[model samples]
Target chain A: MRAAMKDGARGASMTPRGIAAPVLGGWSAASEGVPANVRTISLQAVKIRMRSVGNIQKITKAMKMVAASRLKGAQTKCEKSRAMVNPFVRLLGDTPGAETEQTLVVPVSSDKGLCGGINTAVVKYSQVLNAMTPGVTYNVIGDKARAQLTRMMPQQINNVIVDTTKQPLTFATASAIADQVVARNAPKTHIVYNRFASAISFKPSVATLMSNEELEKAAEEGVNEFDSYEIEGPDRSEFLLDLSEFKAGVMMYNAMLENNTSELGSRMQSMENSSKNASEMLAKLTLLYNRTRQAAITTELIEIISGASSLESKE
Target chain B: MSRAMMRLARRVVGKNASVPVRGASTQSRASIETFMKNFEQHKTSPTMEHPATSSTFASTPVTEDVKGTPEKMKLNFYLPHDAPFDKTEVDMVLVPATTGDFGVLPGHVPTVSQLRPGVVSVHVSDKDVQRYFVSGGFCFVHADSTTDICAVEAVPVEQLDPEAVKKGLAEHQAKFANAKDDVEKAHAQIGIDCCNAMVSAIEGK
Candidate 1:
C-alpha cells in the first residue's frame, strides 16, 4: 500500500519525464532539479508526454476536490469525538503511574496510505517507546502501523488489529479493542497517535491509561480529588471497577477517532499539494514542449533558406 | 446522525418511494397497517414480558470567563458523537445513579456516581424540562456546580420507539440466558438494563 501510494503521489511528475529519457531516474532530479536535457528530446515525443502529464494533472485536481469535501464531514465527526475526553483523566489527574513492569503500547493509524507521514509518525513513536520502556508488548491498531511495527519488533507484538480503515470508528469497535487490551492485564497502556490539530497539522501524542487495579490502588491511596467527592451509589468499589473499565474504552475510542480524522485531513492536504505540484510540473513541461517545437520549426526554416540560396549561386 | 433522525430519514424515503410506486393506494396501506398491528400482538409473548424502567451534556462554557454563581448549575452532557448540552445552566438535573435515583440541584455537593440505565431529566426552567434516556455511564457533579454526564448512548426519551425497545429486550434476555462466560453475561446485562429502562421511559412507569 505504501509503495502504491508513493507511486501515485510522484505520478505524472515522473512518468512523463521517464518517457523523455527511458533510463533516467531520481524522478525529480532531471525534471525539476536541473532544467533537464528535455530540450534535446524530439518534439513529437515531448508532445505525447505533455498530453499524458496534462491528464495526470487533471486527475490529481479532481482527487483534491473530492478529498476536500470528504474532509469537511470527517472534520465534524472528529470535532464531536473530541468531547469524549476520558472522564477518569479529569477526576483522577493525580493517579500514579503503573506499579507493574509490563507496558502495552497501542499505535493507532489506518490501513490505507497517501495520508502523508501520520502513520509513519505513529509507528516511529511506538518504536521510540519500545526503546524507552522494557518489557513492552504492542496492541497495535490499523494495518499500516501494525505491518510496520511487526516488521520492526516482531517478537514484541501482542496483538495486530487491521481493517480499521474500512469504516468509521464506533463505540462498539473501540470497546472491543479496549476489552482485549484490558484482558492482557498490562498495568500501563500507552495509546500513540497523531492528534488532529488542524487541516494541515497534527501533534504526535501518547495518552497513558492505568489498569483497573492501578486505578483502584490510586483511589485507595486517596491522592485524587475523586477521593474527596461524596459517593452516593452502590458499594463504591463496584462502581470504581466499572468506571475504570469504561473510561479505558472511551479513551481508546477517542484516540481512534482522532487518528481517523487526522488521516482524512492529512490525505486532503497531501492531495492538494500533489495537485499543485502536478500543475507546476505541467506548466514547465508545456513550456519545454512548446520551446522545443518552435526550435525544431526554426531549424527547418533556416536549412531550407540556406539550401535555396546556395543552389541559386551555383547556377 | 441521531438515532431518531436516522430512523426518520429512512422512513421518509421509504414513504416517498411507496407513494410514487403505488399512487393513491390508501386501502392497501390501511390493510397492511392492520396486519402489522395483529402481528405485533401475536409476537408479544406473555412469558417474556418485562417491566419498564426509567434516565448533561455541554453548555457554552458559561464558567469559562467567570466563576459560576451558586444560584445556577452548569450541566455538561456529552454522548460519544454528540453534545446535547454544553455548559447550559439548569435548575436541577435528575440522574439514575446505580445507587438509586439522585437529583443534583444548584449548590449541590460534589459527587461522582455510576449511572444506571434510566431517565435523566434536566429542567432548564420551572416549566420546561428536557428528558433523555441514557445507557449506563457516569455522572460527575463537581463542587463548582458544573456537572458533566458522559453516557455511552443517550437518546431523547421522546424519540425512542417502543417496538425497538421490546425487540432489544428480548435479544438481551436471550443473550443473558445463553452466555457461557462472565464477560458475555455482564455485557448482556447492560443491554437488558438499557432496553428495560427505555421500555419504562416509554410506558411512563
Candidate 2:
C-alpha cells in the first residue's frame, strides 16, 4: 500500500511535465527554421526583423498621437457647432411649408485615405438611398468619395468638390453646395456622412435638408418645448428661411467634422493593428531563427564528436 | 581769517607744493572759496533744480485729435473651448514665424505668415505695458485693419506659473544635453525655447 501511494504521488508530479513536454516540443517544431550556412546569419535575420518591428511600433505610436489630437479638436468643434444649430433647427420647425419638386443628396467624405470602411460605408448608404429614390442627384465632396461614387454611380453624381483640408468644413462650403443644388431646381437636399460615436467608433448618419416637416414633428412631440412665444409676418418667414438654410449648412458641416475625426481614428486603429501583426510576425521569425541556429550548432557538435571518435579508433 | 590765509600761503610755499597762481588776485581766491561753500550747500540740499522735473512740468491735456484718430483694429485670441473670455485690448499683434517674430499694428499691410511654436505677444492698447502670450498659430492681417489670429494653441502668461515653466525648460535642456542626433536636439530645443519664453514673459521683464 505504501509503495502504491508513493507510485501515485510520483505519477501526479510527472503528469504536468508529461503534458508540458509535448506542447513545448510542438512549439519548438513550429519555431524551427530552414538550415542555413552560418548561425550568425539566422541571428542577424532575427535582429533585423526585431529592428523593423521596433520601427513599426514607433510609427504606430506617432500616428496614434496625431489621431488623438485631431479627435480632441474634432469633438470640440462638433459639439459647439451642434449646439449653435439647435436654435436654427427649432426655427425650421416653426416654419410652415410643404414638399417641393426635386431632392438632392450631398455625400461628404475625406480627400485622403486610411479610415477603414468609412468612405465605403458612406458610399454604400448613399447607393441604398439612391435606389430608394430614383433620379436623386449626388454632390460629392472629398476625392475619395468622388472616386467611389464615380465608379459605382457615374450618372448619379452631379458635381464633385475637391480637397477640403485647410480647415474644418464650414457653413460657407455647405452654402456653396446648397446654392448649386437650389440652382438645379432641387427643392430638397440631404446630407450623408459618418457620425463620430466615440474615439474608436463612428456610424453613418443621414439628415434631411429641405424639410422642416421632421423638425415640426419633433416640436409637436415636445422635443423642443420652451416658454410660449409669438412670431409675426415677413420677419417670421425670413427668419424661418434663413434659419433653415443655416441649420442645414451647420448640420452638414458638423457631420463633416465628425467624419473627419472618425477617419483619423479608424486609420490610427488600422495602423496599430498592422504594427501589432508586424510584431507578431517578427517574434515568430526570431524564434524560428533561434531554433535553426541551435539545431545547426547541435548537428555540428555531433558531427565533430563522431569524426574525433573515428580518428581515435584509426589511431 | 587773515591768519588762516597766511597759513595757507605758507603751506603753498613748502618744498613739495605745486606752483601757486602769481597773476590772480587774492580777491579772486576768496571769491572761489565763497563759490565752493555755495556748491557744498547746494549738494547738501534735499532737492536740486532741473528743467525736466515732473513736478515742475504740467500734465498734457487729452486732445480730441487723439480720440478721433480713425484707427480700426480687431483682436482675436485662440484659446480652449471652456476658457473664460478675458477681455484684453490689443494694439500690436506679434506672431512667432518660422524665421522670427512678425509684428503687426494698425493699418498693417495685408499678409499671411507661417507660424511656429513660440511666444506671441499682443501689446495691450492704451496701456503700452501689458502683453499676452500665444503658443502657436497663423496671423492674417487684412488691409482693413482686421487682425485675425488662428492659433493651434494659446495660453496667457498670467495663467501659467513661472516655476513650472522653468522646470519644463530644465527637463527639456537635460533631454537635449546628451542627445546624439539633430532631430532629438531640435525637438527638445523647441520645448526648451517655448518654456523659457513663457517664463520670461510671465516675469514681465
DockQ, every prediction? 0.12, 0.01
lDDT of 1 at A275: 69
- Candidate 1 regions exceeding 4 Å error are A1-41, A94-100, A234-237, B1-69, B170-190
> What is the CA-based DockQ of model 2?
0.01
For residue A256, model 2's alpha carbon misses the true position, in angstroms, by 1.2
Model 1, C-alpha of B187: deviation from truth (Å): 5.5
Error of 2 at B11 (Å): 99
Say what the RMSD of model 1 is. 19.5
Looking at model 1, residue A102 earns an lDDT score of: 83
Model 1 chain B, poorest ten-residue lDDT window? Answer: B48-57
For model 1, the docking class works out as incorrect
Candidate 2: deviation at residue B113, Å?
40
Worst 10 residues of 2 chain B by lDDT: B49-58
What's each prediction's TM-score? 0.77, 0.48
Candidate 1 C-alpha lDDT tens digits along A1-315 = 345445545554465456445323323354576665543445556666556656665666676677678778777877787675634555654221233588898898888877789998887667666655568899989889877987877999988888965776788988998998888888878788877778898766666677666666666765355576888675667767777688778878878877887887888888777767767777777776676567657867997999999999999
